[model samples]
Target: MNIVDFSKEEFQNQQIEASHLEEILKDFRRDGYVIFKDIFSKDYINELNADFIDKYGHLFSEEYKKNVFRVGHRRIQVSVELKKSFNTPYLYANPFILPVLEGIFNTEFIISDLTCVTSLPGAKYMPLHRDGAIFKGVALAPLLPAYAVGLLIPLIPFTKLNGPTRYWPGSHRSPLHSGAFEGNPNFIEPEIETGSCILMDYRIVHCGNPNQSDEKRPLLYCNYSLPWYFDSSNFRFDPHLIVDDNNYSDIPEEYKSLFQRRNMKLQ
Candidate 1:
């Protein structure tokens, strides 16, 4: 299936029925992950693609000139464009996204950071790791019971051949003991279509499978957590600054809400 074929209008018009939501939540709780097919519209995808290209196109050139990893490679601690993209209101209040989160974590949640990944052909496999590793340095005295959930939206179709994500079904329940499963030979890769989204527990042991196909696998990962936890994007970008004053009047309600700053009191 061509993952990039649908426009934004089509996505916005797509209705997610009650049954689908029930099945999704059930699979998520049972399997640690669930795929919602064709949740994004082509227009949104195009806008996102153009936005990313205009902002980070330089990375591609730099990679070419330096003979470095360009497509389908792991790049961490990247620039702020990815965060800004995720902060866009359309994503925050996505019809299919929020409800699922509310179902699992109840109503209280805020997106903490965004990770944009583009896996080009021949991209190397990622080491299995839990998203909760970020909390390792916090002192136990003030240790809060914060949890993070990863919302992975694929801009391009995801398949075993295109480096789909591999996950351990029940590993989230015992994250510390999940260990590295990618090299264990028992890992299973889930086939996901473009515009599909997957919600995962931060403690789940997982990794990006290597891409063997010729197409690029681009995905946008939005990490959500309670407001008290440290945000991965807080130090790098301010969500407020990215909004254009002139465009405020035209901004969608959802977008406006996502960009609103929250106050976090240190315990």
Candidate 2:
């Protein structure tokens, strides 16, 4: 299968027509993923990178005390104190994705998880896997609608050396196939730039490749799904809190609605 690409302009009309929506949905259903190129500005990406480095780079430094959280030794998940000031939700909430999400989950969906993954040099290969498994068996596994999707924004220019994500085409509809994690014969590694973003069907079989380069590979991740599913990777807040809790009141009002899907609109 060929890697499909779209532009931000094509989806800039505020309202996406049904025909356009069908075209995108068809490609996603067939290929398991889509790339929107040059959707973000370089300056914006640079700012995000700088901010990430400022916040997480230190944790990786000599002063490392306890802030760094690692999925692996090299895949650092930087937990920002102020989650709201992070990247804007507009990119993830773009017209191209919102329409398809609405079609899958109908009228409502929410962002269950949000975090950034920076794979440093020498990051090992990740075992291919699904983000969530609602159905493990049965004939319906391949035909059931998608319950979750992920939006990946590259914070730096991606190259094979820095380890771009490796994805299997059309695997979103199937059960976990054996030997896929060890390096499947059918996989595509699309080379996208910093301004681009990948919309991935959460059920799709994918894995992170080893970083051959010396630079850090940073990518912001956000997962959206039907309200019923609680993402295992999600950071659930504590209900019992003291007055000295993390100060998040300073975050933008729009950022908070993501937790409840209260502020999202399909149209």
lDDT of each: 0.59, 0.68
Deviation from native of the Cα of residue 152 in model 1, angstroms: 1.1
Q: How much is the lDDT of residue 155 in candidate 1?
A: 67
lDDT of 2 by residue, 150-216 (tens): 8888888889898988888888876656245464678888888877788888888888889899888
Q: After the best TM-score superposition of candidate 1, give how far the Cα of residue 132 lies from its true spot, in angstroms.
A: 2.0
Per-model TM values vs. the true structure: 0.70, 0.80
Give model 1's TM-score versus the native structure.
Answer: 0.70
